[model samples]
Target chain A: EPEVTQTPSHQVTQMGQEVILRCVPISNHLYFYWYRQILGQKVEFLVSFYNNEISEKSEIFDDQFSVERPDGSNFTLKIRSTKLEDSAMYFCASRPDSNQPQHFGDGTRLSIL
Target chain B: AQTVTQSQPEMSVQEAETVTLSCTYDTSENNYYLFWYKQPPSRQMILVIRQEAYKQQNATENRFSVNFQKAAKSFSLKISDSQLGDTAMYFCAFMRLMNYGGSQGNLIFGKGTKLSVKP
Candidate 1:
């Protein structure tokens, strides 16, 4: 079965540096989302995208965060300045436009130093 | 706002046995969707099963089944004939049904129950 794929399975960056997490959602799906799991916390929603625009975002998705479908296939989340608390497992998910279930990727573990 | 709670932080069952993971939610909306996701050691969020709130009949997928109580706001997962492969961190999630112009379904997840299947 086709699944969402995320690049740089593990990423390490300096506290003040910028970081971009990339995801390639299922080719035919129309809705894409970003979620994060801080080491010992529940998975939290970051943002959702459709038609090259953001549908909704959470408080955690503040000024530092931005998402884009730069091209047709790639969905990227860019953090302007990575904070130490920014370390977490970032997941990308997608589903068809209807009532279909959303599927998740293996996740990219972001570590800030 | 909707919240999912998985009370059991850790549970274990012998191989070939059965185990059930409990989950409850607090929601006022009459219509929504519930899901169980498994995150193995690799930490991939894999979809396990789903139950629609409007459906009266329960949902069963092979060895995986759900005991959903709409009134009680409970959705529990029962794993029959458990295997070592079943050992994983299971999460209960909720999503309000999307209106034509609502936010794309964003899943609100629980802390997760860690199931250990001992051989």
Candidate 2:
């Protein structure tokens, strides 16, 4: 079965630097979402996108965070200034339709130094 | 606000045995969806099973099955004939159904129960 793929399985970035996490959602999927799980914690929603615009976002998705489907296949989440608290495993997910369950990517582990 | 709770932080079951992971949620919406996701050591999130609120019958997949009590807001996963490969972190999630034109929805996940299947 087709799956969502994420780039740079692990990323180490310096504090206050910019970092971008990339994901290629399943080809035919319509809705896209970004979630993060801090070590030993529950997964938390960051943002959801559809029709080329953000549909919803959690409070954790602050002004420093932004998402874009810069191209037809790639969905990227950019953090302008990384913080220690930003370190976590970021997962991208997509679903074909309303009734379908969201398929998740392997996840990108972001580590801030 | 909707919240998912997995009271058991960790559990263990012998190979070929059966184990059940508990989950409960607080939601006011009448229609919604519940799910179980497994995160193995590799840390990949994999969907295990899903239960729709409107469906009276529980959802099942192979050795995995759910006991969903809509009135009690409880959804638990049962693993029959468990194997060592079943060792993983299990997360229970909740999502409110949205209209067709709205976003599909984002998952609200529980803290997760770490299952250790001993051989």
Candidate 3:
């Protein structure tokens, strides 16, 4: 089965630096999403992207966060300036069509120091 | 806004036994989807099963099955013949059926239940 793939499984960055988490969703998938989970917390939704645009975002997805589908298969989440709280496991997911179950990637563990 | 709740924080089952993880959600929308996802040690979120709100019958996959109560707004997952491989964090999620254009549908997820199957 085709699965969502993410690059840089583990990322470490300075607190004020910018970082980009990349994901290659299923080739035929049209919708993409980003979620994060603190070490011992629930997975929280960040943003959803479709048609190369953001559909909806949570409070955690503030100005510092942006998503882009620069290419047909690449969906990326960029954090302009990271904070200590930004350190978490970031996951990328996609669904083939509306009302379809979503498939999730292994996730990128972001560590900020 | 929709909220998913998994009351159990942790559970354990002996190998070959059965386990059930509870989940409840609050959603006024009539059309929606509920799901159970497993996150192993690798932290890869894997979809275990799904149930459509409109379907009165529950969904089952292999040893995994769901007990969906639409009227009570509850969706629980039952794992039969639990194995060591089944030890993982299980999450219950809800997604509204709204069309956000092409493929992007937003999902609301519960806090999750940590299940440990010991031999």
lDDT string, candidate 3, B9-108, tens digits:
9999999999999999998888888889999998999999999887999999999999998989989999999999999999999888765432346778
Full ranking by lDDT: 2, 1, 3
Candidate 1, position B35, lDDT: 95
DockQ of 1: 0.69
lDDT values for all models: 0.93, 0.96, 0.91
Off by over 4 Å in 2: B99-103
Local accuracy of candidate 2 as per-residue lDDT tens digits, B84-106? 99999999999998655333579
**Interface Cα RMSD per model, in Å?**
2.1, 1.9, 2.5
Which sections of candidate 1 miss by over 4 Å?
A: B99-103
Quote the B-chain TM-score, candidate 2: 0.96
What lDDT tens digits, residue by residue, belong to model 1 across residues B6-101?
999999999999899999999998878899999999999988999989899999999999999999999999999999999999999999876563
- Candidate 3 lDDT over residue span A1-113, tens digit each: 89999999999999999999999999998889999999988999999987778988999899999999886879999998899999999999998788688899999999999
Q: Is candidate 1 or candidate 3 better by DockQ?
A: 1
- Per DockQ, the best of the predicted structures is 1
Quote the true-contact fraction of every model.
0.78, 0.70, 0.80
User: DockQ of every model listed?
Assistant: 0.69, 0.68, 0.67
Expressed as tens digits, the lDDT of each residue in A2-110 for candidate 1 is 9899998999999999999999999999999999999988899999888889988999999999999988999999998899999999999999875888989989999
